[model samples]
Each structure stands twice: as C-alpha cells, then as structure tokens.
Target: MNGRFDLNSLPMCGAKTRHGIPCKRKGNKKNGRCKLHGGHATGAKTELGQLASRANAQKDFPDWFFGKPVKTEYVIRALSSYEKLVELMLADEIDWDTVFDVVEQDQIPLEMLKYYIMFNVTPEALIIIQSALDTYYQETHAPHLAFHVYAPMIVFHKFFRQLSAPDREYLANWFKKYSSRHPGYNW
Candidate 1:
C-alpha cells in the first residue's frame, strides 16, 4: 500500500459521513448558522441608515431651537396672532383697589374678572401667560401656571400638589385670586 494507510478506527478522517463536520448542510449558502441566521444580518441596520439619511437631508437648525428654524412659514402666519395676544395680555394695569372691592364686597367669582381682559391662546399667548404667572407669583407668593413649564401631555395626569410646598402654595393662592377677582370669566 504505497506507504499511505487509511485508519478506519481513527474517527474517520474527513469521513464522508453525516456527522463529519456537518458537511455545510444543503441550504446553508452563506455558512455560519446555516440559512436561518446568516443572511447578511443587516436589514434593520440598512433601514435605520436610510431613516438617518432622510432625517439628515434637511439642514439642521440651531441646537437652541430644538431642530426648528426661527423663520419658518408658520412663524410668519403667527405674527398677527402674536400681536393680538400681546395686546390682550398687557392691555390694562391691574387695579388692586377694584380687586379688593370685588372680592370683599361684590362677592363676584374671580374667574369672571379674567374674561374681562381678552386672553388669546397662540404663540404670542406664551409671553402673556408667562407674565401673568409671574405677576401672580409676585402678588400672591404662589405659582399660577403649573403646567406651563412642562410638556403639556406629561402634566395632564399630575396635579400642582406634586410640586414643592412653596410652588403648590403659590399656584393655589394665585389660582384662588384669579378665580375670585378676574372679571373676565366666561362661565
């Protein structure tokens, strides 16, 4: 035998048997874990890459604007609303004397007082609301607008009581005053 000896007892060298290194099973085209786990392993990554590409297609705005530009068409359209809101917000000075008289004597609901002054809800309303909240805090030592600072959706389920004692106190007092003295209420 030309000095080459085939040892059948030596675990079958490259044995041509079903268990010999599992012979790259029939449908295992890409190797590694057969057809089940080997198909390029990238569909999700490719989809994410495409998504990122699309997202990056637009020029990013300044980081301060939260990816939104300052001069979008909506801003232009809201200019008039902004003006109206501001006008409504700062139209008149608060008359503490009248407020006290109404509260102490007239026994009117303060919310009624709020409607007397037109309060517009628009982009401009933001500043007005802020100013109102600030003034309420200053006058009553309480917070008037609790949900204004947080995402509106998130604040829905929470009450101002969840805030710090001082914040809660302020909001409560301010709301009380607003509901009692503001003459512009609709209801």
Candidate 2:
C-alpha cells in the first residue's frame, strides 16, 4: 500500500461568502475552520481590547458581571439583631464586662462588630460599642483587638462618614495613638 495520505480526502471549511460561494480556506482538523476563518480566534490582545471583550462578555452573562441582589429578609434580620443588642446595652442589661468576656472567650465573633459597622447602626450605639471595645483593649492589652475594632472604621470610610465631624476626628486620633504604640505598624 502507498504510505502517502490524500489531501483531497481532508474536510474543508463550510463557511459561505456574500456571493453564496463556499469558503476556500482549509478547515481545522477538529473545528472545521482555517485559522483566519475562526478556527482559534481568542478574543482581545491589548488592555483596551480586553476591556471591550469584558464588556461584551458582561452582555452575555449579566448576572455574573453584576452580583446578586441582597434579600430584604436578610437585611431585616441583621438589623433586628443589631437593634436588640443595642437595646440591651442601652438598658444596662449587657455591661462592658460581659461584652469583654464574651468577646475574649470567643462566644461572640469579632466579625459581628464589623457587621454592625457595615450596617450603619445608630451613632449612639456605635459610640457605646467603641467605648466597650476601648475598655477591653486597655484591660486585655491586646493590640489586635484594638486594630480589629478601629480598622473597620477607617477602611469603611462610608460608615465613618455617618458619624459627626467630632466623632470622625476622635476616631482618627484614636487610630493614630494606637498605631503609634507599635512602630512601623500602619493600617
């Protein structure tokens, strides 16, 4: 038998042109298209091209581009929990000592505090929470605790903006003082 393969037996591109003629380009082995005829045309090379590609991609998969909306029930539940905690604090039911103990013992997560800030709880409630956290920091001498409590205030500036001007300045000064205690520690 002959060792040579016949080129005429290979498949060609089925793409048509404006004149209703078949594309003369050789088809890819797998996809049946030449490179110039979209055999392996990956989108975009430059940064601008990438941006345009992303924009087009968003149109195809919009939900992936824009995150899912938050459920109203979840928001209500979070707000209610925050309100109850604040009420308990204001009513003198939960003192600083209890708060400190619960936090130090890991019964309550530090992330809960971050969430309170994220939810923009009442300014009065925030002041109370901050004061309790400051007391805990002083008594426990935990730099991490102080950082965790204050870092959110600075990082989420929108939450800080909700505070009065004087409150904002106070927090800024407090952060400066805390950060200075550990030289070279900047957050």
Candidate 3:
C-alpha cells in the first residue's frame, strides 16, 4: 500500500453523496465541499447562467414544493371581493358580532387591514378608526414592531360600542352611499 489512509486524520467532504453516504474526499477550504460536489464551481455570473441555475434547481422539485399554487384569475376576483367586503364593513360599524365574524371566519390577516381599513375611509370615519387604533396601542403597550401598531379586533368592538347611536347609525348606512358606485361585487 502507498500509505495508511487515516480517516480521522484528514478533513472530510462531509456532504451527503447520491447513495446517501458521506463523501470521503477532503473538503474544499472555502465551502467544505469536494470538487465533484460544487467545491470548484463559483456561482452563476451571466444572465444565461442564472437562468440555467434556476432551471436546474426547479427541475427536481416536488409538487407544491413552494407552498400552495395560486390561480391568477381567482386571486384577482378574491381581492376584489375582499376590497368590497372592506367597504361593506365600513357600513356596519356598530354590530361587533358581525365584526368578529368578519375578522375571525373571513380569515383575513391583520396585515391586510393596515391600509384598506385606514386611509380608504372617510375623514369622519378616520377619526373614529384612528381613535380606536390609538387607544388599542396605548392599552396593549405591545412593541411597535409590525406595520400596524394597532390590530386587535376587540379594541374596535369596544370603541364602536362607545360611539353615540347617531354615529353607529351613520356607519350602518355608510355603505348605501357608495354601494351604487361599486356594483357587481357579491360581498
């Protein structure tokens, strides 16, 4: 024999091989890979190389590997419905039960409410929503980490409850004013 091959004495590739066994070759100093396992290869530089690299990556991917597949047309329609629902929600501000259902069963994440539930509202409505948001922020004292400093649905319920009957009635009727402007939405 040329020499003794002491496994522990040498640095190993350590990367799994096609047969699911560890490669015995010495690891590259840079990335701990053997030459055949991309140790000698640098990343894609050219546009064509990048495209080829992406294609190679996706070629062996399993079904639904990147999470659920979204239908483009369905997504468009669903967004339209959600926007319409938000408009409708602006109408029934008094019914906290309905509000709870909308937030809970509707499965709309709080992230969705940041803009659509804020600036899209009327100035008078803004005062109401903004006041509730401020109160929620103050009460919770949660870290102002997310885009929405206030997102608790319960806070809105309490705020709406405290509103005068006239304001509630106005919100309950607000949709009627804009419903005609936005037709064809089933929401």
Candidate 4:
C-alpha cells in the first residue's frame, strides 16, 4: 500500500519560483525539499566553519609550536591537562589573567588552549568554551569579548544539541526503577 499521498491533495498556493521546486510533496501535508536536492538547509554550516577554514587556510602555526612534542608522554600529559583545563573553565568563573599567569610561571604556553580548541574540538566542547569565555567576562567585567564569543558558542551549542539523543531511554528506565524504589516525590 502506498502510504504517501499526492501533492495535489493539498490546496495550491501560487508558485513562488519556476526554477525553485515545490516546497511541499504531493499529498504530503508536511513540507519537504524538492526533487533535486536533499532536505532543506540544516543550518549546520555556519559562519564559524567559514572563519575556521579561512583562518586555517591563511595561516600555519609553527610546527614545534603547535603539533605534539617528540616525547609521547608529554603529548599524553598535555592532552590530559587540556581536558582538565576545559573542565575547570566550564565548572566556574575564572581569571583569564590568573590562568595565563600560571602558564607563564610554570613555563607552559597559553597557546595550548587555542590548539585544543582548534584541533581536537567536538561540538560539546563549545559549551565549556563559551562558559569559559563567560567566566572570563564575568571575572574581568569585559562585555566586549563576551559579546564576540557568544554567537559562535550559541551556534555550536544548537548544532550539538540537535545531534544529541534525548535521555528518553535512560529517563524511562530511571523512572521505572525510581517509582518502584520510592512511591512519592514528597514524604
């Protein structure tokens, strides 16, 4: 049985574009893409993608300055530190200058943050990154930089959230077990 309906089944709106294809499929009330292309623009490719591509294409970091060091242990340690740094940044507001001070005093470079963001970043990391930026702004009372970072952070967060699975299964399981364990939320 053809479960689908024809486009003609719906009311016909005046054609917007001859070249532009029908916005809705036949008999299918929900809107969909035309024959040629896939579904509508997902809004996945954002200005950040353009900026990253432009920056990377335009400039190359010094090899030793950016890439993993010769010592495997150092590379591993640096990676671990990178995760810790991101987590810490997300957990609370912090002094950017204080962080840099530690880096300088310890002889560790601040470029590490930049590199981690650049190379190993996933969409989830952007949340922490934006939090870190907010933390910096809150600590320093700098609205200017915070304003700049906000857009990219929001964009990345939206994209990531869309891709993430809802905790439906986990929550369902939890509720089932939870109700069995405790009958009421209130004592």
Predictions: Cα RMSD each: 25.5, 18.1, 20.0, 19.1
Report the lDDT of model 2 for residue 86: 62
lDDT of 1 by residue, 19-85 (tens): 5454333333224243433456553354234434444554232121232232333233334433443
TM-score each candidate.
0.20, 0.30, 0.21, 0.23
Query: Candidate 3 — which residues are off by over 4 angstroms?
Result: 1-121, 148-187
Residue-wise C-alpha lDDT for candidate 3, range 1-187, written one tens digit per residue? 7697654654788788899999888865567667888444688875335545655675433222223333344334434434544554567554545434433332323323333344444335444433334444455573433422222221233244455676556654655654666787553
Candidate lDDT values, in order: 0.37, 0.52, 0.46, 0.42
Position 88, candidate 3: lDDT = 49
Which ranges of candidate 2 are over 4 A from the true structure?
1-85, 105-119, 145-154, 158-187
Candidate with maximal TM-score:
2
Off by over 4 Å in 4: 1-69, 95-98, 105-117, 121-187
lDDT of 4 by residue, 113-149 (tens): 4334434666465455445445555665644332122
Model 1 Cα shift for residue 118 (angstroms) = 15
Q: The CA-based lDDT of model 4 is what?
A: 0.42
**Candidate closer to the true structure by TM-score (higher is better), 3 or 4:** 4
Where's the lowest-lDDT run of ten residues in candidate 2? 146-155
Instruction: Tell me the RMSD of model 2 versus the true structure.
Output: 18.1
